[model samples]
Target chain A: MLKLDREIRDAIVAHAKRDHPDEACGIVAGPEGSDTAARLVEMVNAAGSPTFYEFDSTELLRLYREMDDNDEEPVVVYHSHTATEAYPSRTDTDLAQEPNAHYVLVSTREHGNSAGPVEFRSYRIVDGVVTEEDVTIQE
Target chain B: MAIEVRIPTILRTYTDGQKSVEASGSTLQQIVDDLEANHSGIKERLVEDSGELRRFVNVYVNDEDVRFTGGLETELSDGDQVVILPAVAGGC
Candidate 1:
């Protein structure tokens, strides 16, 4: 099971809403432990539409280096689906290079309404297979 | 009944901009054949001529990965969702 803190979930939702009509992408960094609470590190707008997301690996390398400097490692990678559900896209499954990393997705479709809860899902992509896991968001 | 195959955006260029298509088959291979019959070259994009899935592509049935199940032989029932996902590279 994967768990997220309230602040992290809110940060992801905020990023998704900020990039509405397009995709938003980011990574999560934290300690390497089961009890470690992940936090959203860097957020960016995906350069393309829902069909594609171009995360600048150069920026990622910088962030990775920064995390290294901070003594933290990226533990999760996340992105948002603007008009789609919080399900892993085919592109997401194929590009999942970090098997040990948790893949998180947030759906911001039903925005602005009280019932429009942000949908968050986590997955582990290994060898071209995406395995869904139960995600617990701590309040 | 035929199952519905949902195509993602990247591969839609090959399917003439079709986002979702319907095909008849019980197994994943049969569905691929049906897709090829209609789209002509979709099979080549999803699978190699040697009958192996492309390294950059992934097929999922109802959110469960076909690779972990039976791969091309994975049985399909009505309303099963087949998602073809390719690797996405980009970000900074």
Candidate 2:
């Protein structure tokens, strides 16, 4: 199970909503090897395509260097699905590089918090396989 | 001459299951060619017969995606960290 703070979860949801048509992507950093996601780093979607998302390479470089300097690593790598369910696509499963990080997906298809709750899910993708896991939001 | 190339799980087979390996080059293409010399068949997975990066392969140098840096022609240097990932897609 992935233990996420409610505030962090809400913040991620808000980001997803903010980029409704374009997928929002970011990472939560934690102490190296600790697996605790504590810092949120929002990234620009270079593609800015409703159907695709790519992190700005320069920003990614900066983030990685910052994490390295701070003795941290990405613990939660997340992206939103504007029109799909919260599940890893084949490409997602294939792209997952951090076996230790939780891959979070938030679907904004409904695109409304007032209408109904959004689909938020987490997964462990390792070696081309994707396994859906539980997400516990701490109050 | 030794630049650390981080390997994703799916591509670990080409690197004897190791998560990272060393390659040398002044540009990204040369480095991949160097990788192929040690770990065969990897070049095919990353590049197409058309010499273009396979549609799904995403290569990065020091956390910067190569697409914006010149694709396979991206330059490299000592101690640079190269990462390769597949392009993930999500939508209904």
Clashes of each: 8, 0
Q: Please, what is the TM-score per model?
A: 0.56, 0.76
**Lowest-scoring 10 consecutive residues by lDDT in candidate 2 chain A?**
A109-118
Best of the candidates, DockQ: 2
Which residue segments of model 1 deviate by more than 4 Å? A33-35, A46-48, A112-115, B1-92
lDDT of 2 by residue, B1-92 (tens): 78898776568889998978999998898998999999999999899999998866778887777888999998888889898765433333
Model 2 spans > 4 angstroms off: A111-116, B1-22, B40-45, B55-70, B73-92
Candidate 1's TM-score reads 0.56
lDDT of 1 at B17: 79
What tens-digit string does per-residue lDDT give for candidate 1 at A1-139?
A: 7788878878777877777667788778886544355667755543666545655434544564476567665577788776777888776776666656788887777882233578888888777898889888788
